[model samples]
Target: MISMIMVLNQKGDIMISRQYRDDVGRAAADSFRLQVVAAKETGTEAPVKRIENCSFLYTRHLNMYFVALTRSNVNPALVFEYLFQLIRILKAYLGEDFDENAMRNNMTLIYELMDETMDFGYPQNCAVDVLRLYINLGNVRPQDEPEPSQLTSQITGAIDWRREGIRHKKNEVYIDVLESVNLLLSSNGNVLRNEVTGQVQMNTKLTGMPECKFGLNDKLVIDKEKEDRKPGVEIDDCTFHRCVRLGKFDADRTITFIPPDGEFELMRYRVTDNINLPFRIIPAVQEEQGMTKVSINLKVIANFSDQLYATHVVLKVPVPKNTAKAKIKHSFGRAKYEPEQQAIVWRVKRFAGKAECHINAEVDLMPTVRPKPWSRPPINVEFQVPMFTASGVHVRFLRVYDKSGYHTNRWVRYITKAGNYQIRI
Candidate 1:
């Protein structure tokens, strides 16, 4: 019984060895056949001659046999050795300029071979280390009559590539390996790692510009001569005159204005004296119906010496008399009023020692008279005039008025004045 068992075991071993030899022979034959076909398609007679050479055939068959062994179903230890040998073969091929399309096709074969043995699980560290070795070998530049000994020495001194040990798992690992191999083949040398390092450094440097802030107290001063170019007020080119300071007040501050056409210039100043307090004066931007609206914000500080009193804001606008008419609209909370003119008058209800107030004034334009003769009529141009006095002092409503006057009643005619003048008091 013992003799029979020994004979069976020996027969089994021999059968396995024969199968392994057959697999290697088949792989080498298939690879050589493909190479011959490719050579014929490209009309390359040299490839056929080289394959026929004794030394070339021997090396080719040995490399293909190793590649076959690496993909075999048994002996994982031998598989690792064969994989390393295959790496060396790839390094040699990649060192020379090979057809990019052909290399891509061959890589698919290699992928399949590697996948088949994945169940046995490759040594994670060995795979990375071997890949690193291949990367170093592929980076060597070819010289006239390149020496294999010199190239091998250079690769040996290079850092171990496998130190990272397939850091990424599953699909990522496969993808990275494929990319590394493609890069090596494409460059005819290893330049991908260096290029990637440079890109990362550049990206880091670009992400460092400082953030900007438009602070509340920051003022933008406009140089009238440099900024304005139009005949009338240039709204778009206007700059912020003063940054609103929280505590102190900016009294008697002036802002220079330039007309759009550059034909006229005006200087505007804010004044808060014993009779008035610091307030914001906003200019009208648009006209609706027959009125133009202007917004105003008035604030009286606690330490301000002036007693809270009535406030007045002035504005100037050119209106074509034949085409446009002007009216004033003012609102204080829910209370609203519209008068026929350009100035707004604010009356304080109670002397609240110190208080803040906001008022909106709108100026609208309308045609003073219709085009038909029957519809035409005389129109009154009224301007708003504001007056303020001490509490005990009795002041008449008409104590102060605009130099342009209260109202101008003019008859509509074809030769009527072409423009209306608005003045804020």
Candidate 2:
């Protein structure tokens, strides 16, 4: 339930504004521009500011502020999620051109999309794939624009994500299980907080409406089947797309639903327990002789499979703001001084697992008139491990049933990526 939606540029100029209810006025737009943008207040400090009995909840995008106004005390999460979904859909349509210029060029299509997505301040069938079915942008209305009733019927249908009479030449499905592990490390090499956030993305190229059932290594399913309950990670919490049937999942812990045609995020989950950390970073910084010069010793060791290698490994180690120059030495990587960021940047093209690399840097600080104490920042590490998952999450099975019963093949992939993986220096 949103009453009004407004898009403003970085300069607080309204690019677009739409009012769904009479209670929300045009003046609410100026109030938001004045209170949030002009005041330079972040959403963290004041996410929801009420004026004239209307609440304006806003979030900043790349070069715009997406402001949502609601008269009733509706769910804030619902509003924010819808706003994000709106952006994703636009980006899907515009691709790399999803910016201010793109918006200006496609204003007509944008308004049409806004009308299709929201009605009476409630979201309808706004899934990008589903929307692209009828809202043809190419002037050739995708076979003469099926009548309004036909489109509306499909929109209100149970399987709105999939259009009827859909068929693909190949009968195959590919599922990608990708996880990003985030960690906040304390000084002296201690793990302060760590978690794994994962997503299951599916690309289905099949014929007919295939009723699919997905399985995970959940405790309830394992206990009911009396199967081999292997030692794996537990999914703490999960959220699924609308295509996923919530009733069936709630009843049997089974993911039973009709997936969308193209690539769509099926489910997202978080794992906190039993996270296998793949890297260990040790950093030591101390005064070599005086405050002007400091010596730093850093070591990065990969703890995963010895046969595998991490790609695009980057380490950003911070130094004092008055860093004049940095003498860098490394074992298996290239290290350089980044004066703009006041940090020592290191890079390794390929880091073999079960291997270790080291970096040593002597940073000379410029003589500052006022020598203040330095507050060191963490050393952030970034890498991608293919065919690996830090959470140990595996797909148990994917069973598909269709009226056609055409044979099908399934493919699965696993990847682990860095999500704010840092070590306090």
Candidate 3:
């Protein structure tokens, strides 16, 4: 009889024979039975029978195979490193017989493993190492050398192009790979190569387009000319189009006329619905100056066309100034003038058994003195006088005024000596 022993070690459990006994022995008999069944079913080689058994060598070989297969299921990083190192070792020892498939697989595996690991947290050194490995595996040719299209090179270029878009700092690398791809595709006469190149060139040209505009819009052109146009009236000259006045008393109303050129005119006058009146003009004689005084003569009509209260009429006249005293004689009364103040005050009385109206006014003269002199020290004097009306009415004229009364009042007189009085007894 023979014995079979089962052993459990660090690698795994195995069954062993203690001796190679006769075919009739139980251990040998069981082995032969399993071989007979396998040969009968599949018609293949039967199990081998060892004449001498070595447990240590068998156990060693079994553990080595088991460990190799187990490591295949481990993390790819370790697998990649192992395979990479194996390629290097094989290249060093086995020389040209080094497995190209194994090297390529390991290089690709390293790249995939690095990408996966860095998905959660980037590892710069690992990524660089993977790139270096790929470059080495692709066997990058020198600039002068013409090499055949390699699978590894094509895959590496694609990987680097994608990485360039992600990491813009590697833009040169992306461009280089793209150029290589173009060169390859162009060599193969690919249609897509021409299309992509044309598009890139077109985009580059568009980016360099001119930034400035040349012509103006219509509104802007019109506004530019309009800005330079001048206003209708000159600034320094006096201008008048029409005149109108409203007041309570007819005698209180006075118009002072300072002739612009030596004379002026009241060209047109109209009276509307406010009064049933006809407009007229009157001239009075000045005894001292021998000048004719101009005034308005207005008379009330018994029946008029429009309403009696509201009136609107146009009076066209040249521009007038207040300098010389004048009077407005009305049917109702008369008003007095203050020459220095450029104003009028009306006076009323009964004349020819009816109420008559009159006005006295002072007019302003055009400024003869330059505006700068008024700020200096000045001497002032005041006086008064009384004059009688034609109806024996007592009236007073006061001249408590300045010599430089207005800009138009020139230096006509100056006091030379101070008057003093002395009495001797």
Against the hidden reference, what TM-scores do the models get? Answer: 0.16, 0.91, 0.12
* Candidate 2 or 1, higher lDDT: 2
Q: 2 or 3, which is superior by TM-score?
A: 2
Cα lDDT of model 1 by residue, 1-425, tens digit: 00000000111111111122222332333344455433332233432223222111112322122222222234534444545544444444454333334344465444433433233334222332233333333346534322556435533433222121111121100000000000111112212211000000000001111111111111221232334322221111222312222122222223211111101111111111121112222232333334332223322222222443322222222223332322333333222232443223344333222444443433333444453222212111211112221111110111112232333121111110101222121
Task: Return the candidate ranking by TM-score, descending.
Answer: 2, 1, 3
Best-to-worst order by lDDT is 2, 1, 3
lDDT of all the models against the reference? 0.25, 0.85, 0.23
**Per-residue CA lDDT of candidate 3, range 1-425, in tens?**
11222222222322222222222232433333343322342224321233224111111221111011110123435433433443333343335453334333454543443343222221222322223333443456544322334434523452321121111111110000010001111112222211111000000011111111111112223344566343211112112211212221123322221111111121112111111111111212122221222232223221211222111211111112323545444344434454543334332222221222232232333343432221211111111111111111110111112132321211111111111101010
Model 2 over residues 1-425: C-alpha lDDT tens digits?
A: 78988888888887888888888777777887787888888745767888778898888768788889999989999888888888888888877447787777878888888888899899775788778877656677666345778678778887788876677888899999999999998877778999999999999987878899998776667777775667545689999988899999988899998988879899999999888898998888897545799899987889899989999999999999988899988997788998887789998899999998888898898888878888888888899999889998888899999987888899999999999898887
Model 1, residue 255: distance off in Å is 40
- What is the Å distance of residue 256 in model 1 from its true position? 45
* TM-score for candidate 1: 0.16
| Residue 29 miss distance in model 3 (angstroms) | 99
**By summed lDDT, which 10 consecutive residues of candidate 1 come out lowest?**
173-182
Against the hidden true structure, what lDDT does model 3 obtain? Answer: 0.23
The number of the candidate with the highest lDDT is 2
Question: In each prediction, how many residue pairs overlap at the backbone (N, C-alpha, C within less than 3 A)?
Answer: 25, 0, 18
